[model samples]
Target: MRLTVLGCSGSVTGPDSPASGYLVTAPDAPPLVVDFGGGVLGALQRHANPNDVTVLLSHLHADHCLDVPGLLVWRRYGPEPAAERALLYGPEDAALRLGTASAEVGGECDDVSDTLEVRGWVDREPVKFGELSVTPFKVFHPPQSYGLRVVDSAGAVLAYSGDTGACSAVEELAQGADVFLCEASWTHDPGNRPVGVHLSGTEAGEVARRAGVGQLLLTHIPPWTSREDVLAEARAAFDGPVRAVNASESFDVVKSGSAVRRQTS
Candidate 1:
């Protein structure tokens, strides 16, 4: 399976990168986009057709899914409009929230049912897309959130920690994954940071170490956070390779310690 980093900035759009978004694709399986945050729709055009891919949102935070409305626009009026409604899998409130965002009038949610086939993600239930099986694990985040575990036909696993804090469920979702796409939104500061909302770099590393994942690909680092410090924290905890992913970077998921070979596109 191929994984692409559409954007990796945390919380908000940074000067260099947009907010959170990712692309995962494999042969025979339809292209899957993990999130459609700010600036992602434009970025996706470079790699895949927005009208053809299935969208899986980890949460409804603006940085993680605000651009989904843009997708609705493209699918409804683009030069070549999609033949069918776009498939979207997210939280139970996804349709209501996204529909609200797409609303044209005041206080009235747009009937997005026509433009998108909104579906809710059930915890631990595997959703199949030809060669790939995606499972969502409940996470310790606001209203509702989940980490996605994707396994290919060949057993290559790509586990995305979505936007989560330290929790056993996160580790379970990442257990034995070939690539652990975790979020380290902050440097290690337990005393000041809020609890059960986001993870520090040290915590991310701890999760990777505890899960025994093959490779640690850190993401969701905010612009204000120190990347080098986060990297140092993760490397100190995880003996395996740990990389802070950047926008446009791509990886080939493999079942080895040295898995996820990076390529700049």
Candidate 2:
């Protein structure tokens, strides 16, 4: 299994990176694109065909799903006609919200049913995608949100915390994962942050430590926060390796003994 960082900026697009997007691919299977945020469709096109992948959104935040309309545009009017409707998984309102956003007329919801087969994810139930099994766990966040645990046929686990503050559900989703792609959107200073919307570096580290994950790939960092400071804070709480992931960076999932880790790609 391979994991690709398409974008990692938090909240909004930054000078160097887009908002939040990721890609997970397995041999001979269709790639799964997670969170197609702003500027992601263009970046994703550089790595894989837009029409040949499945999309999963952690939430409907603009930074997490705004580029979905771009994808719909490509699939609907690109050079070659779409072979079939691609799968789209997210919250119950995904189709309505995204369809409306992609509509040509003002206040009209485009019938996206022609472009993507939309499905709402039920928390804790594992959905099969070729050789991969994805289980989503409800997490603490505005509106609706989930963290995911993806297991490939090889048993290599990849867990993503999505966007959430510290919660037991986040830790449960990440339990024993090989690579925990967690969001660390703020510094550790409580005096400078708000509550219940996002996780600080220290809180993200605690989740990694409690979950006993093999490696921590911190992501969703905003431009204003210092990467060095966040990484240092995470490192203090997690004994294992913790690295801040950047756009276009890739990791090859590998297993050793009973542990799973990624070789830098």
Best by lDDT: 1
lDDT per model, in order? Answer: 0.94, 0.90
Candidate 2's TM-score reads 0.96
- Best candidate, TM-score: 1
Backbone clash pairs for candidate 2 read none
lDDT by residue (123-196, candidate 1, tens digit) is: 99999998999999999998699999999998999999999989999999999999999999998987889998
Candidate 2 positional error at 132, Å: 0.6
> Which residues of candidate 1, in runs, are more than 4 Å off?
none
TM-score each candidate. Answer: 0.99, 0.96
Worst 10 residues of 1 by lDDT: 255-264
- Can you give the lDDT of residue 38 in candidate 2? 98
Residue 7 local lDDT, model 2: 93
Model 2 deviation from the true structure expressed as Cα RMSD, one decimal place = 1.6
C-alpha positional error of residue 130 in candidate 1 after TM-score superposition, expressed in Å: 0.9
